[model samples]
Target: MFTRADLGKDERLDLMEFTLVLEHLGLSWTRAETQDRFEKADANLDGFISYAEYRAILEAQGWV
Candidate 1:
């Protein structure tokens, strides 16, 4: 999932890549919901979600 979402292959997911992951998962989230999830995963608010953060979020969602 992390590799798939890291579209840029930068080992991190920017907002666009995150959105793609949600879409790929067929998760229909509102704009606010998506932003909220992104913010939660991006613990450092660095505008990117690292593999660790992505894994953490997936684990929290029971998807890991």
Candidate 2:
């Protein structure tokens, strides 16, 4: 999931990549909802989601 979502291959997920992550998990959300989820997942508030952050969100949201 992380690998696929990291479209830039930069080892992190920006908002755009995060949206794709949601889609990969069979989730459809509005821009607001998607941004909200992405913000929540970015635990460190680094403006990007690292693999750890991604995993944390997956587990937290029961997507794992």
Candidate 3:
């Protein structure tokens, strides 16, 4: 149950945009890895992720 409220104090990005970024990295949205990343990105337990969240993960995981 992902929603915008999960962002907490983090910045915000559209859900589609977040999914797109992951897809571009060859990550399957239906896979556990994607789900894990989504949970991490959601931060405050909300269902959405901000661009900053994506950037943080990209940096941490060296995604690109």
Best candidate, lDDT-wise?
1
Question: Tens digits of per-residue lDDT for model 1 on 1-64?
Answer: 7797787999999988999999988999998999999998999889999988988988899996
Candidate 1 ranges with C-alpha deviation above 4 Å:
none
Residue 19 displacement (Å), model 3: 3.3
Task: For each candidate in the order shown, give its overall lDDT on alpha carbons.
Answer: 0.90, 0.88, 0.61
Candidate order, lDDT descending:
1, 2, 3
lDDT of 3 by residue, 14-47 (tens): 4555666666666676666666677877776667
Worst 10 residues of 3 by lDDT: 1-10
Q: Predictions ranked by TM-score, top down?
A: 1, 2, 3
- RMSD values for the candidates in order, in angstroms, are 1.0, 1.0, 6.7
Candidate 3 segments exceeding 4 Å error: 1-17
lDDT for 18 in candidate 1 is 92
lDDT of 3 at 3: 34
Please, what is the TM-score per model? 0.90, 0.89, 0.54
RMSD of 1: 1.0
